[model samples]
Target: MGFLLLAGAITAEVAATTAMKYSDGFSKIGPSLLTLLGYVLSFALLAQTLKTVSIGTAYAIWAGVGTAAVATIGVTFLGEGLTVTKAAGIALIIVGVVVLNLGGAH
Candidate 1:
């Protein structure tokens, strides 16, 4: 249940970030609203997730996965460059998240 909420938060955050990219500095009403809504939903879900998950573990996973997913989306869909350094950073984030989960967030 907690993991499900965290996943929802991650998905909402990623969607919000993507919408932000298209928001044109918040001048575009549609994407701007979407960005706001997505973030609101994401945070709400994250807050619910914290009820069962440890803050350290939940936050690490949320931030790490959200960042990696956003970066991948940027590279794949937004024509952003995927340099070796960027790839390495994403991998490291993933590893860190895995370590945190395995280490036990008690």
Candidate 2:
């Protein structure tokens, strides 16, 4: 299903981004390679989902949700500090993603 593919892409992207953070300026070979492979699979899955999903809606959900998730991981797992402004920004992105899903019925 399109949802499955999209979810896979999002998961892959999150994993890729997390590894990229641990890549240590690309000094770590395993994480670096994992990042590249994850991205490749992510894009491939995204392309498959585009066959059925509308481009604008799909892209907005994909990017908006992915951004929020990655930022959350950065703040929580990666020890990345979060300022008030950044938190508010990520909250807005989550709102946008919820709105996009709600509009699916229209």
Candidate with maximal TM-score? 1
**Error of model 1, residue 106, in angstroms:** 5.7
Residue range 1-106, candidate 1, lDDT tens digits: 9999999999999999999999999999999999999999999999999999999889999999999999999999999999999999999999999888888873
Q: What are the runs in model 1 whose C-alpha is more than 4 Å off?
A: none
Candidate 1, residue 15: the lDDT equals 98
Winner by lDDT: 1
In model 2, the number of clashes is 0
TM value for model 2:
0.92
Clashes by residue pair, model 2:
none
Measured with C-alpha atoms, the lDDT of residue 25 in candidate 2 is 89
What lDDT score belongs to each candidate, Candidate 1 first?
Answer: 0.95, 0.88
- Tell me the tens digit of each residue's lDDT in model 2 across 1-106: 8878988998998899889988998999999999999999999999998998877877887788889999999899878999999899999999987887897721
- Candidate 1 TM-score to native: 0.97
lDDT of residue 68 for candidate 2: 94
lDDT of 1 at 3: 98
Once model 2 is optimally superposed onto the true structure by TM-score, how far is the C-alpha of residue 87 displaced, in angstroms? 1.4
